[model samples]
Target: MSNEQVISSVKDSYLVEKRRNQMIKGAIVLFKEKGFHRTTTREIAKESGFSIGTLYEYIRTKEDVLFLVCDAIYDQVRNRLESATDWDNPSVAKLEEIVASYFRLMDDMQEEIIIMYQEVKSLKQESREYVIKKERDMVAMLERMFTACLPETIDEQDVSLLANNIFVQGQMWGFRRWMLQKQFTLEEYIERQIHFLKQSLSTDHMQNEKTDQTP
Candidate 1:
């Protein structure tokens, strides 16, 4: 499901990974500026410090580069989330820490996140589906963490909604920063969001408890 599956004329695995990483870095900049359709493979090659011929050796088409970039970005986000989170001991405080970490990551990778959203449609259907599946996997990770920390009385559907909301809220900081950043600093935003999530969870747990107590 990664760009490793992309056809490469190069036989050396290390060189293939190295050059593809270079391609991903260069392509993200161009994609952010020109979009996927407007950017040319030659431009990607030049930006990546490879000739067109050398670039073709590693990728069959420009779509391949886009897929690589998307895959790399998702891998980075997931790896960072894994590192920041403590799955062994789930708690509300740990969930808040994970959400803050995710928002901070979104802020740091705003350009890459924007490019992924803007250019994802240009990818082939299979590649696009793969990218979407990766996204769902991350959301599912949050859902698992939420399930572990939330009260048992909370409905499954509400837990899923909470998990999805947390995921999108992190993304909103990147895609909607023009408005959000004008209104709040990053620390202020994280504090307000974490507060909102806690309030919602507490209210839901209280309601569920009341339902159980009803004769």
Candidate 2:
């Protein structure tokens, strides 16, 4: 590559990785405090240690920062889930691993997850579309993870809904942490959620078998 080409590539890659993270780091603080709708680019710039002008070099608006935060949270969750889970494992096993990984992340990055939950609705039109696609992608990943655990009777829509439900419950866990922590440690809480989940969706058919046999 020419020297100018190499310089541009380095600049682009550095900006791609750095400024976005700077935005996410700044956003975590602002969104937690002022909230998504109330926060401003200048404030985000202050928190992120960049001027509003520099911030705009990477992103055009506060809404962009909002999406960056959402994307960052998902990226972290995806990494945790992928590393801690064995996708080729049986459906039930994969589900358990996914929950474990998810709970680990929620406990580890509680603040960031909390920020995403609180701020996602503030994303603007194109920005909202970007995040919605990422959200769907996350759901799809879990749906595939749900595949092995599902019985023949369950449809994909059911599995997808169940995956979305689990995601929702996990998100709520951060919000209801006072109540959850009151009852159990994070590990114990995860175990409880998994147990309850399996009981609700997983064992119904088996119980039906016993009921059918008894007659």
Q: Give the candidate number with the greatest TM-score.
A: 1
| Per-residue lDDT over 21-139 for candidate 2, one digit per residue giving the tens place of the 0 to 100 score | 87788888888888887888899899988898877777766766776677777788777767766755566766687787887777877888778766777766766677677778877
User: What's the lDDT for residue 177 in model 1?
Assistant: 90
Give the clashing residue pairs of candidate 1, or none: none
**Predicted structure with the largest lDDT when compared to the true one:** 1
**TM-score, each model?**
0.95, 0.80
Model-by-model lDDT, in order?
A: 0.89, 0.73
Alpha-carbon RMSD of each model: 1.3, 5.2
Deviating ranges (above 4 Å) for candidate 1:
none
What is the lDDT, from 0 to 100, of the residue 209 in candidate 2?
A: 64
lDDT of 1 by residue, 95-144 (tens): 89988998998898888888999889988898899999999999888888
